[model samples]
Target: MVVGLGPGSPDWTTPEVREALNAATDLVGYTTYIDRVPPRPGQHRHASDNRVESERAAMALDLAKRGARVVVVSSGDPGVFAMAAAVLEESADPQWQDVPVRVLPGLTAANAVASRVGAPLGHDYAMISLSDRLKPWEVVAQRLSAVAAADMAIAIYNPASSQRTWQVGAMRDLLLEHRKPDTPVVLGRDVGGPTESVRVVSLVDLDPADVDMRTLLIIGASTTAAVDTPTGTRVYTSRRYHRR
Candidate 1:
């Protein structure tokens, strides 16, 4: 079973996922995700680096084959750029053909972040990962350009990290070619975590230095609007599109 733990908060974790974790005899996942689950008696955890997803999937399958009740944990929805795909890919192998797989959904980072800042994704939107580790930079750039030209809201994941720091700025530049400089951009960092912060800025003011792997960016469409409420500012894309 592959379960999503939601976005770094116990309140965000679903009861179904909690039940699966309690029933699991062994847990296999990235070290950071594994550490999120409190240790319990008789349950064994096999944690590894984040980059070894294939190996981790195989390890979970091997454990399940040996009569262990294995659960693979991931942050956010497991099917959304998370462990579900990796496990399903590994399960296609003839060696693990008989192993049964189940995926449990949880609140995705995009939805969690959007909720914190009203409905920036109220209309058509695209979700893209800025990381080039698995795919080439050219492909990433092409997708960004296409989405921008289509005038759809965008949810960007894996924007930057210690090793990768330039992609966000490049994205902002490419987006400017198709979008307005005053386009609303929402930055959500560690949403649901203790140090959580959600703020809005213009596209031209989006600095790469402010983003990290933990940050999720929402770039609004041409129809998106930002209104200053009594409590705070709320951003949302218009549900009705105007005829061009």
Candidate 2:
């Protein structure tokens, strides 16, 4: 079973995920996600580093083939830039062909962060990962330029990390070509975690330094609007478009 733990907050974890964790004989995942599983007296935990995702999947497959009820955990929805793809890639191995793999969904960061602010994604939007780990930087740049030109809201995942720090700034500069400097942008860090924070700033004012691996950036489309009331700020995109 591959389960999504839902953004580090127990409140976001679905009942299905909780039941899977409870029934798991062996739990395998990155250290942080494995730590979220509630401890069971006889359960075995296999915690690996963030970088060795394929190895972790292989370990889980081995345990499963040996008749252990193994559960693999991902921080958010497993299918979205997480372990599901890795597990699927490894599933192609003939030795693990008969393994019964199951994927459970959870709240992904894009929609989670969008809810915290407002319905900024009410219109067409593009979800892209800025981590060039698996893809080339030039391809990422071209997509950003096209998305900006098409006037679609963009949800940027894996915006910045300790190792690769320049991409976010480069993305900001590229978007400026097709978007105005005053376009609204949102930076959500550790959403649903204890230190959760969401800030709305102009495209020109978005600071790359303020973002890290835990952050998700939402860039508004041309039709997005922000309103400030006594309660706080609310951002939304009109469902209908009007010709100017």
Candidate 3:
């Protein structure tokens, strides 16, 4: 079974995910996510570093095929830029085709972050990952340009990482071409974790240096608005409606 841990917050982990983890004889995932799972008495944990998803998925499938209940874990919703796709892709191999696999969903970072801010995603939006590790920078750039041209709110994942630094700035500059310099942008880091923070800024003021692997960037649409209340500022994309 593949399960999403839903960030590192205990409050965000679903009961179904907990049940899977508790019953699994083996768990496989990246070192960070695997560490999130407590050491179960009889369960074996196979932890690998970043970018070894295929090997990790194969391990889980092998364990399941051997009659062991195996759980493959991802940080957020497995289907959203996470391990579920990798596992499903690997399962297509004839050797692992018969292994029964179940994927349990969890809250993705986009939704979590969007909720923290008012509702930047309430209108038409697109989710894109800025990571060029799997693809090319040119491809990502084209997609960003197209999405910006469409004036869709964008939820950017993996905006900046240790090795890749320029994409986030490039994204901001591209969006600036189509969006106002003062367009609201929300930065969500360590979302749902104890140290989680959500801050709003402008497109021109957004600094890629402030973002890391765990941060998610939300570039609001042209219609997105921000209002300051006594308590704090709230941002949302107005859902246009005409009263009859």
Candidate 4:
């Protein structure tokens, strides 16, 4: 099954995902995602590094090829920037074509963070991963500029790491061209887990030095609005598509 695993918190694991784990003969996922599952008796684990997608999918396919039931794990809804895509990509091989693959949805970091900070994605939004390892920086910048100019709420993934210091600052600068410097920014780190932390601040006050691989940043568009309600200030990224 392709389980979302939901934001790394046990509470986010849906009953369906738990059932998949309990019945699995083998588990395949990144180390951190595998750690979240703990150890169930009689279950074998195949953990890989952050770099190996094809190898991980091959491992799951082999286990299932040998007639073992396997649960491929991923953090946060697997389909959203996670392992589910890799599994499907590899499953297209004729050798594993007949294997029955089930995908279970878990809460993705974006949803988890958005929930905590009111509705930043309440209307239209775009999710962009700032990792230049897989994408060219020029392309990343173009997308950032276009989306920011389009006034869509942007959820940035893989914002900053020790090795990738400048993406966040570059992104901030790009957005500043189209968005107010004081626009609200939501930084969600290690969300939905024990180390979970969240902060809401303005773009001008955002410090790139505070970001890491575990952080997810939500940047509201220039046109984004916040209205005080009984519950809290609700934020929305406007969608001109709905305007008549």
The candidate maximizing lDDT is 1
Cα lDDT of model 4 overall? 0.84
Question: lDDT per residue, candidate 1, 1-244, as tens digits?
Answer: 9999999798999999999999999999989889999998999999888557899899999999999999999999999889899999999999998899999999999999998889999999999999999999999999999999999999999999999999999999999999999999999999988899999999999999999999999999999998889878899887999855
Clashing pairs in 4: 1-102, 2-102, 2-103, 2-104, 4-78, 4-106, 6-107
**What are the models' TM-scores?**
0.97, 0.96, 0.95, 0.90
Give candidate 4 misplaced runs (Cα > 4 Å): 226-244
Candidate 3 residue 2 C-alpha distance from true site, Å: 0.9
Backbone clash pairs for candidate 2 read none
Off by over 4 Å in 3: 241-244
How far off is residue 111 in model 3, in Å?
0.7
Tens digits of per-residue lDDT for model 3, 1-244: 9999996587889999999999999988888889989898989988888557788888889989999999998998998999999899999999997898899999888988988878999988999999998999999999998988888899999998888999889898888999999999999999888789989999999998999998999998888888878767788987783222
Q: TM-score ranking from best to worst?
A: 1, 2, 3, 4
Maximum-TM-score candidate: 1
Candidate 1, residue 7: the lDDT equals 96
Instruction: Report the lDDT tens digits of candidate 2 across residue range 1-244.
Output: 8999998589999999999999999999888888877788999998888567788889999999999999998998999999998898898899999999999999888888888889888899999999998899999999999999998999999998899899989999999998889788888899988899998999999888999999999998889887777766777877788553
Q: Per-candidate RMSD vs. true structure?
A: 1.1, 1.2, 2.1, 2.6
List, residue by residue over 183-207, the lDDT tens digit for candidate 4. 8888999988889888777787788
Candidate 1: misplaced stretches above 4 Å?
none
